[model samples]
Target: MSVQTFKPSVRVGNWNEDISLDEDLLKDFLEKREKGELLLQKSGRLKKCILQKVELSFSKDGFLHFGDVIMLLNPENSEESLSNPSPIYGNYTVSVNPDESALSSKTQLTAPCGISGISNVKPCARNVFIITSVDGSDYGEPLHYGQNFALRTRDGFMGHLYLTSDQKTFLKCCKKSHLQEVSLTDQPSYETCWQFVYLDPQLRMENEGVPVPANTKLLIVHSKTNRCLAVLRKYILWTFFGKECEVTAHTYLNGHKAEENENHWIIVTGNPSDDINTMFDRPKPPSEEMNENKCIVKPLQK
Candidate 1:
């Protein structure tokens, strides 16, 4: 194991937008600055400006850092949608439901719909998210257990992730552990904060406050409800993302999540250079531990 240190990236653009400097806007802005039309006030590192694309934050060391731009990928499943032109399955990324196409515009405009307990709320907003520190901690901060963090969307209306009370009547068996829904809010309220629970509660004593490695199996517990973030084999005919699976949040009624792997998630973030569309097909590390060691103890019951 190597100590992977990720130096935070410099960000430009409006709030929550990790500007891809490769855009034409960067060239246009830089040319103006060089021509004396755009003046930059000198700062610690602003004596001279360079225009090149900096990578988005993805952790390299074994742990996921606070500022890493990550995707919450549920484990792969054999299920597929019956109606799609191509196969759509359950190796789904936890994403925000975006604006739908003309055929599906019934999916209302995609933006923060105020708070979570409302009757009408959808959790999935955008595909990608930035793991941010709850207290405005400096960039590249290591995310540790027992610490709170906020998940802010990257591609669209910037909002923090929150648990919703809406019943996804559209989903089958809507009363299961996946019963409760997840959505985004316009502000970072108590509902939007979350804590990471290592599937192996034994790891807690040693790894508390340590950086969590990428690809490790973990439970994302919603701070407000104490329910864990989960995605089932259940697929929804999404207006925008095709037949993507529903990303919901809830703990099991019996308190033992031992029944299924749907409640587990892996942070498959990579270096800015890694492929965004790729997925780790190996068995979920946490599930494997649970099976081999019979580990049902995240304070979880037998």
Candidate 2:
């Protein structure tokens, strides 16, 4: 039996538009050059190229920006307000680095700060929150093994966490660990820096809402390993009942979703007298007194 392959039809309308590939366009340009319709360099290098801009009446859901032009594919019903959306209107720039030898290009998209759609956002450093696991342990100090070190949170020390110089990475006070024992230091160092980011915005929005609070159902991400800081529930049970449960409340460096309960954290800052539990609900707006750099880390109340 012979099988027939299906070919999708391209429909150009108010919502849809088709764009020609560079290869096809170049091929046509070369053909035109042979006919003396277009000029080419003496070395046959196509240095100067002009592409006709394609227009769309409505902006699609997954529209992509190439330089100043916005490319829409399988557009949705909704349309964008402006002809060219700037970074202020959630439109950002995409950079493409092409390698002639490799015949490949590396592309990167970047959005301005405070935009919701971008994932590479540097966390607001004005108020640094010392994240503590639900089990009452702070992400300890940095311990050097060789040339590099790891960030570990130990119980009983104030983990004053802050964004690194890059603003995308997290760092805390440094401490030296020998064998299984840990020792604290008075100063902070770059060795304690960590790459931490928020969980998927969609998932976070489903669980909570926009303008996510520090104490809500959120995941503290470890950027380098793509692991999450989770609590081991068994540890809590073992601590209280001496039931010999495994230590489950620890930073998850591997991609595992075993401990969800222990993963939640409470971010505390500001006045020492204020109730930590109510801090998330009644968050003090950024004011003169409660400036961004002046944050106080406190332990979670039992």
Worst 10 residues of 1 by lDDT: 114-123
C-alpha TM-score for every candidate: 0.55, 0.24
Highest TM-score scorer: 1
Q: Supply candidate 2's per-residue lDDT for 135.
A: 24
Cα error, candidate 2, residue 250 (Å) = 6.2
- After aligning candidate 2 to the native by TM-score, how far in Å is the CA of 107 from where it should be? 53
Model 1 clashing residue pairs (backbone): 62-213, 63-212, 96-124, 96-125, 96-126, 97-124, 97-125, 123-182, 123-183
Taken over the whole model, the C-alpha lDDT of each candidate is: 0.53, 0.26
- The numbered model that scores best in lDDT is 1
Alpha-carbon runs more than 4 Å astray in model 1: 1-56, 77-89, 99-110, 113-125, 155-178, 202-206, 253-259, 271-302
Clash count per candidate: 9, 12
Tens digits of per-residue lDDT, candidate 1, 64-143, equal: 78777776766543333344434343355665454312112222323442211111111123345688777777888778
